[model samples]
Target: MKTTTYNIDRINHLIQQYQLGKEEFLTLLSEGLKHPLTWEAVFKEEIQINHLKRIDKIFKKGLSYYLDPTAPVTSKESSIFFRKEKFGTNLNLASKKIVSQFEDLKISLSGLAKLSDINLERKLPVFHSHDNPVSVANTVRELLMPRFKKDPKKFLNALIDTFAEYNILVFEYVEHPSLKEKTNIDGFFLQPNVIVLRRNQDYFKREIFTLAHELGHYLLNQEEIESMDYDQMAFGKISKVEAWCNHFAFAFLAGNELLNLDKLPNLTARNDYNFNEIKTISDHTHLSFSAILTYLVKKDKVSGAIYAKMRRNQEEEIQNRKEEEKKKRELEKEMGKASTASLAKPIQSPLFVSTIQSAFFDGVINEFELCKTLNLKPNQLEKYLR
Candidate 1:
């Protein structure tokens, strides 16, 4: 049986929030529904359940949100949206949605923590831009050393675990194909303590660097949204905070080899720019060989021309790899086999997991709420809740 939903007010509010006019909203729905929709029908409560579900998908809010009597919150006074004047880069719709989702999760975590009497206070000390990044990096590295791992995947997972230990909530969201738009930004830090990263399957090393860079911002108590491009680090004019963060990330990742980086001789054709040594350091640090070379250029250890040539070579290599992968996928298709592509899963923060578990055990949140908060299935809840 068909049902009517008279949620015009909520629908209109979302339309306004998305900066869409009534006609535009209806047009968008029509495209998705494969039929023309009119605002007149919406006003008269003639919209069906299927229509409401379609609208809910667009808003990313559940259907129950529209059924509730209360309207969605529009105030941004307490949000990072209002607090941070500059994001360092403009966010696309997908990036903005991911950020908003994590912000909402942080709020929920805080509320649940309070109900369970959990002390979620951040422990890392804050520093100013004038502070020596090397000194700060050394201190933070010492703190995280206990969680250190050499392998790339283990290294990233270790970092996330370390961040959780310090009361910093780390969350990763994937740029899934089903999303209306993919997020261009790599990661961002939300003040008071939440860091969000976009999952990168092809290049996990970049994700590791981004995590350390955002950690720099956290230690400096500065909030920022950034893409973390190596090319920009080598050539672009950046603010003091950004430069500090870059240096901190480098020093933290390099560990004891930071001094070696400073003491290294200038690269010249005579020694082939010490490529072998650089590669060794890169492997140890899990930073890309190109990124390490770029850092050398930034420090004046390598000339701009050499950096540019090496960068071109690296780009060419990457392109060749992509072509190879494409051919392999095509071959797989011809063989009636599935293409082998890495499917990434978001890394869960241990602190975030335990907080929801505590909430569940204390009766602050029910079983359904527990699964929802943890983003787990009913069968998966036992591993966490137990």
Candidate 2:
């Protein structure tokens, strides 16, 4: 078999463009390829690709995580990400919306930042495509590199623990339980206070990023606006306040240090976002296979034309896999039992704290899972537990 080598400079450029690291870039690249797999796959048992494809529905109605405490005077525009996507009443309506909710964060970013003990020292690689939504979201992943632990569970536990500390409710995940839509994502919040998660979403790497993005909205007080979202089309057109919230998510997860665009060399064009490389990085960062590939295309590390083709390929693969699953489900359905799964750990009661020692002493699990399973993972669990 021929080996696919990556172009370091090109990979670096894409990493820089999307403020990604070698691991994050490779994970997404691999996911969208002929046989996408993240670096995490090496340690993880090979998982069948789950094709829970569906649009991300963000609600745009709740009012949380949007207040800027430090600012003495309230300002109307507390953000930098926006383009007038339409004219006429669209502009007027959007302007009115932005004006009304600029400095009204019910939640606090700095407070959450201070509360987070998950480690926030990763250097974010700079990406040139600051204007792109995908680029920005991927950049947020950079902020999380500093806390990278080989064990996926630990990373998630830390995130969830922090969310719980913040009074977020953790939800029991059931796959596609919602009649509204389906998703590959592990966790999502419904509105002012409803979080839906697929506890079955076991990919550690991508799950971390998803947790961060969704929580970012809460911390930045964009939860209400996101709740109002009726369609995915609201992504770029969301209020400036919402844009800032997303930027904060990207910045917090990816971090400013790692994302300096100056480091991106033209050579990153050769990162080769192939199946093997993706596996390498995903293994390192523990990101999800699907997210790893999505980030690569968004970063422009992979060609647009090629990315489109890969999307089609992924769809076909999903179709084939779904057919196989249908057969499995048909067979399994006869048993008339539900999937057997449990929380990583027994959730702490409404009481604010649980000892790390208690988890290990209980003999419920080993040392590693105990340390992380304090209920943290970032996205749905993060918000739910918060």
Candidate 3:
């Protein structure tokens, strides 16, 4: 039996690099090796080939990683903010996996850009912490054009397109079989230009708002993960940054017209403002119902108590709607009919796709590599090629 000698220093370094304590490392080792206790001896002296293989698998690293002192470390630091609750240990792992995927995609896109001789520069507008949210929002809206804001779906696509034009990478994560229910984050922004959105949102309006909110983080260059509910945007509870961003998103989506309360129909002076009236405003502005209500509260048009009650009612309504949709899907399955819900679409930026295609045509990458990088099947390659 052949035995390989590993530098004990490197082994210890890897353990620290992964932030794995001795006890946790032992537990991970115990899953593979029957006599985990003996691994301590191997760690101090020399390891058998079989033991080395198991260790590599446990650490999720290549065998050569332990041998080479100059090998680059792969750990990345990320700060994620959950709007609902802090992630549990399992959920944290899931969130990290998502971040890792983003990192990998960014690296691939960056390499493709370099090979294609494309210049990727940051072109997003910058705003100070104390900058007026309404002014910033108007600026962004003008830049994005008010025409795209007419339809929520069109608005979202156009927003992504605009961000891509500015060299920002925006992606929507479709809940595929492999990634179902692993993470519940609504959206997240990664520094230097990467934003991700979950594809299973109940409302396109919510997605639009989230995109705007994440854009806020992008402008401020703050990395965050958020569930981003209406309560988080409430006047008193939210941080200054969130408040500014929420206002910015409102202005961006609702436009300067909504800034004038007189434009809205007279409120009935009822505790909760009429839902129908709010719905009308939402439809006309292409803004979410919650956004309208939040603005009302901010303007002191709606009482805090009323706003809170409305929020709860809205949440209940959303829950009921989701339940109804779930049952509807189940019924469709029974009837052998396709689901009403749309399938998750690929979320690659247009620029990213074009760069990859160009690289493929230039023979910098082959068809297989292109398909793999784009997360596409063989059939999908033709669409890009043409």
Candidate 4:
């Protein structure tokens, strides 16, 4: 076998980038390249070209990426705001890669917007730290058409579309194949105007809440990646900004009617609200059960102890449902009826899609460039174009 030499320092850097230990690196080399080499060669700072090729393949990076000493490092200038309780000081490599991908997508969308002559200077409503959360919510609500307030689905779609109109880019990040495990990042607001949402949440209501929360960050001009929970709002334990954002999202989604104490069921000593009442409110407002519970807690209708109990029950119910799903999938697999998991659907802003299509039609970008920008194959282009 003709073997070529590579820089040991670059090899070590690549291993670090992939978050691999020496043993794991050797295992990857043995498994991927089918060569079980000694640690002595690595200690001597020598690696075969074939091994380098295998390393490049495993990292999904080019050979030159490992070879070039001046290769640009991934930018970490942007600040990430995560919930300390969820992932304290343990930002995983997978999460960082996801953030990098988000930045790349934002750059592509911005370039396409500029090429299509779209107005990138559109103004978003501004809110100050001192502004009352309710007032800010009302201001945002006023910007939307009256129809959106009538339905939850319409409200969410309209909110996202409205943000896009104001030049705020919203993109959903689906976990990539390279990610070892899901990251706790529910959503993040990037500098200037970019919102990236993790598609791990099963409920659309949660996604809606995340969108609203990130929008609050945008309005306040604060950049943060966060895993927000309604429970964080209790006793003002969270930061002032996070608390404000939560309140803004709550008021925005729940609306002023929910704030009227007289409209809600009166909480008695026995806590006598029936399932019918819960269903009625849920149907009327289209809020999730968990969201309703949170609202009641926020409105002081429920005690913290009761709220915590309800939250626990809700989480248990969700876990049970997931277990049922897992069993069903297993049974399907055993019966040879299991379906292959579908490819991840990348969520793009409607405005971004339109701009890309416009650029393609106007000869500003070719088919290959269009497909690459959209993260689609040549054959998949028609599906998006149509």
lDDT of 2 by residue, 1-386 (tens): 22222222322322342234556545544554587545454222222213101000111222121112232222222221121222212222222323223212212222233344322221233233234544555544443234656777676666565555444533433333443444323344422322333343434444555555555544443433222221221222555544444444444544432243213332133554365655655566554445444445435555556555655676688688879977887777788867453434423423123323332344444545543544455343333322
lDDT by residue for model 3 (157-205), tens: 7778877878877888876656433665678877778888876546889
Better of 3 and 4 by TM-score: 3
Number of the top-ranking candidate, with lDDT as the measure: 1
Q: How high is the CA lDDT of each candidate model?
A: 0.80, 0.40, 0.70, 0.68
lDDT at 35, model 2: 72
Model 4: ten consecutive residues of lowest lDDT: 79-88
Residue 150 in model 3: shift from native, Å?
5.8
Q: Which scores higher on TM-score, 2 or 3?
A: 3
| Model 4 error, position 22 (Å) | 13
lDDT of 3 at 64: 78
Quick one: ranking by TM-score, best first?
A: 1, 3, 4, 2
The digit string of per-residue lDDT tens for model 4 on 1-386 reads: 44554555666655654456788777766774445766775445455677677676555557776666564443344223221123312455456556656765666667776887876664866788799987888878777423545556555566667777777778886766575567766788776788888764456667777888888888898777667566765544677788788878777766755555336764454655444666666665546666677667766777777777767887898999989998998999999995786756756777677878888987889999889777888778888877
- Report how far off residue 363 is in candidate 4 (Å): 3.7
How much is the lDDT of residue 59 in candidate 3?
51
- Superposed Cα deviation of residue 47, candidate 1 (Å): 8.6
Q: Write the per-residue lDDT of candidate 1 for residues 184-234, one digit (tens) a residue.
A: 799999878899988877678888889989999999988998897788899
